[model samples]
Target chain A: MSIIIDQLNYTYSPGTAYEKQALKDISLVIEDGEFIGLIGHTGSGKSTLIQHLNGLVKATGGSVYYNGADIYDADYNLKELRTKVGLVFQYPEHQLFETTVLKDVQFGPKNLSLTPLEVDLRAYGALKQVGIPDDLIDASPFELSGGQKRRVAIAGVLAMEPEVLILDEPTAGLDPKGRDEILDQIAKIHDERHITVILVSHSMEDVAKYVGRIIVMDHGRAVFDGAPKKVFSHYKELEGIGLAAPQVTYAVNALRERGILVKTDATTVQEAKAAVLAVWKG
Target chain B: MIRDITIGQYYPADSVLHRLDPRVKLTGTLVYIVSLFLVKNLWGYLIAALALAAVIRASKVPFGYIVKGLKAVVILLLFTVCFNLFLTSGTPVFEWKFIRITKEGLYLAFSMAVRLTLLILGSSLMTFTTTPNELTDGMESLLSPLKKLHVPVHEVAMMMSIALRFIPILLEETDKIMKAQQARGADFESGGIIKRAKAMIPILIPLFISAFRRAGDLAMAMEARCYRGGAGRTKMKPLHYHGRDAGAWITMAMFVAVIVVSRRF
Candidate 1:
């Protein structure tokens, strides 16, 4: 395991009138090269729990260990830790302050104190990884479309060359096509790079298509953590907490409920289609 | 993170103050602020405070919420009281090395604190009863006469209304950005002043860009709707001055006169 969170707790505005316990005793281990999907409703502590992995949020109680070392140890350099576990915030295009997209992408690698030639090489490589065009590299990030700006933001983080990558609601506010494009890009990155990817999303379909393991949270606690098929099997419990399994899984379950033979584990439309075809042919 | 701001908090109520015309409420607030400054004596201060309390009770806003609003400025209030107490030289009630707390000074500090407290409470009363849209409409009507001075009164009011409308949206966006940065291991707390400030760059930069993008989109939308520079613009709901509004103005005039006369004592 590359990241291990043991009984992590987090509270916002800890001593003030606005104090809120956003996370409660969240414990999870993320192994290297695994794609994990984190899903929860608003204010469910999904964001709070993930932030502990990179040292952005210090645990109120318990500890987070990164590669066998406590991240909160006084001797650990946080900036270095951040570089090792890159975070790409939602709508990162907003953080693009450089005059050119290339310069903005170079920011993280430059923070690493790399040679100028190395910085440019890493920046170019990062931009390519996120599928940004060469001609657009020198153009201002502000001039890009909403979806393009999002890609540029992702590239900025990739330039840091972290061992693990975390993204929060990366597809939010995007049209269906835009959402699919970004998700496809991220999936490709995970497949090729073999870096541990933690994706926080509310959409079941996206998680079903991309992540291998699904972690479900409710009211600041991790309630379920398993493969998509195993997690979706607890349909009633998920529905009680205002969450639903992927549409195909729900449809398959409905068919089974109606006394029609179907596999309830079918998560994607393609899988459901294949299962139905097999039953008809039989 | 930005949602914690409590500015322009509106308390929903069905009281007479809530039913009153927003223009009347806006004018009453202006008159009330002027009266607070005019009063210099204990009796005048007490009367103003009493009037504010009456308004607060009539508005039916929770006393706890009003007190919470005051808590934000408690430090400033204390500084004002201390500055007046030790700096004003009069018949010394208590003295220390190079410092004297006088009877007049004590009275001044007490009155000053009461004045500021009542001033904030009174203004909050207006906000609590009046929605931002209504307040902006009232402001536009009130400033309409400034058109003779070539001032774009309607434009200013429209800008204020738009700004007010975006407060919640901006707050929500800020929350999203904060979560996004936090997920990436961008530590926001437990850093030195400079380190903390540098941490804000990731959040702030994204917020500003999004805000600008929103502004651009709003401008285009407005243009598509044929919105000009307030020229020949007609309102959907025109403000009507009624008998009750006139009565409110008269009552406010009397209230101001009472405070001014009480100051002469």
Candidate 2:
């Protein structure tokens, strides 16, 4: 099922002195099997926007429709919506509380009111999909390394079999190898499961390498939403909001500035390399 | 959802009360609370209420803000009022079956409720006018005499300050953890008391773990700066009483005199 947000607005602490407009008049549609990157600096309301998808935060004004039904309606089942649109928070591992990794992964499906056998089966499948070996499944999640714990957390969400998975800053504070492993796992999940993936990150390079579309947020507004190259082309505007394009976009732009003929639309290292090679071959 | 707490929250203002020394405010609050309890009749309570109103206005903190702190003690206030209203024995003003309404009970309940409300307002006013740092300094200075008995006055003050500082941070952490658990379908609402308590297991375990983790990090941070039990440390800005503090003390004394005189009639 697809998700549509129309003219959404959210204000924190409404009617109080500390009131702040976090999301303003945002409208967007996410189709099935789309890998979308939501990019913004901290406090830009990207997280707030996504929270409305699962009915976590109600919009002060406007509506969010999931599968053409308003999830905020009284008749709608919020628990089912949350299960279908999984949100893995910034530090998912902090939510891991069960004694064993298997139990932690089973926590989501168990909440779905599924039978014991199906819950464990889904947990096993999610663990295997996240590449957690069977030997470590029965051990305490706290005993795992940071990356392993993160995967277990992700597996916990995956066990619910969500059609759309939203991960906020999934690779934050990880080493280079851990970052790649997470990015690869997310890509694999999207490729194999055909679930719409929404990745929220401030890192341009990571998103540029994976996501098909990018939505740039600045000061509670959707400033840009397009392909990675199209979004990177507005590097100056992005930099104004304390965000930057991928390093390859800068390299390509610098080459063009020096009167060297090359494509300035490159958003990845490989794309920049190919552009430079094409110029040299000509 | 835990963000509505107003206790220990400071409101920044540039009024006379805000400018007064923290020591004076703390002592003044103590005097005010004592005077509230000293009140025996309507006249005494009126005096205390007037004094409280004047101070709240001078402090420039909205009365509504101070009243908001009462939300935390609402259940306690209700219990006290109800117990005094029903259980205090005296001449029956009205009678119905097992329930007896006495004139004395009515007066006692009204006085107790007013006193409790004033007490909360006076104390909350002090916290509202004083920042946590200033409060800590005032507390340390006020309790320094206890050091003669080998008490760890400075350590106690530091611990109080740290505890105050962590309230907001931990509240924010709790909110985030709650949201995370909710996303995992851990239903914190819509369950019986026992079932709801069971639901909290998922949240409480992680909360405790993170709390310990944060405490460890804070300890390391303190040690990195060579912090050692608050010994041999001097204040960057030492607390000193000014003319305003003396004026405040006199005002508090006058208010106490009012309470004493009003108790007579």
Q: Give the best candidate by DockQ.
A: 2
List runs of model 2 lying over 4 Å from the truth: A15-17, B94-97
Per-residue lDDT of B1-265 in model 1, one digit per residue for the tens?
3555445666667787877788999989999998998987888988888888887888777676676667668899999999999988889999889889999899889988998888888887888788877888899888989999999998898898788778768877877777555444456786799989997887788789889989999999999999887788777877788787788788888899899899889
lDDT of 2 at B262: 87
Candidate 1 ranges beyond 4 A from true positions: A1-33, A40-85, A109-124, A161-164, A173-178, A191-194, A217-224, A234-247, A250-262, A269-282, B9-19, B46-50, B53-121, B141-154, B171-207, B220-258
Q: Poorest 10 consecutive residues of model 2 chain B by lDDT? A: B1-10
True contacts kept of each: 0.33, 0.67
Candidate 2, residue B156: Cα displacement in angstroms equals: 0.7
Q: Write candidate 2's Cα lDDT for A192-254 as tens digits.
A: 999999999988988999999999998899999999999999999999999999998999999
Native-to-model Cα distance after best TM-score fit, residue A170 in candidate 2, in Å: 1.1
TM-score of 1: 0.72
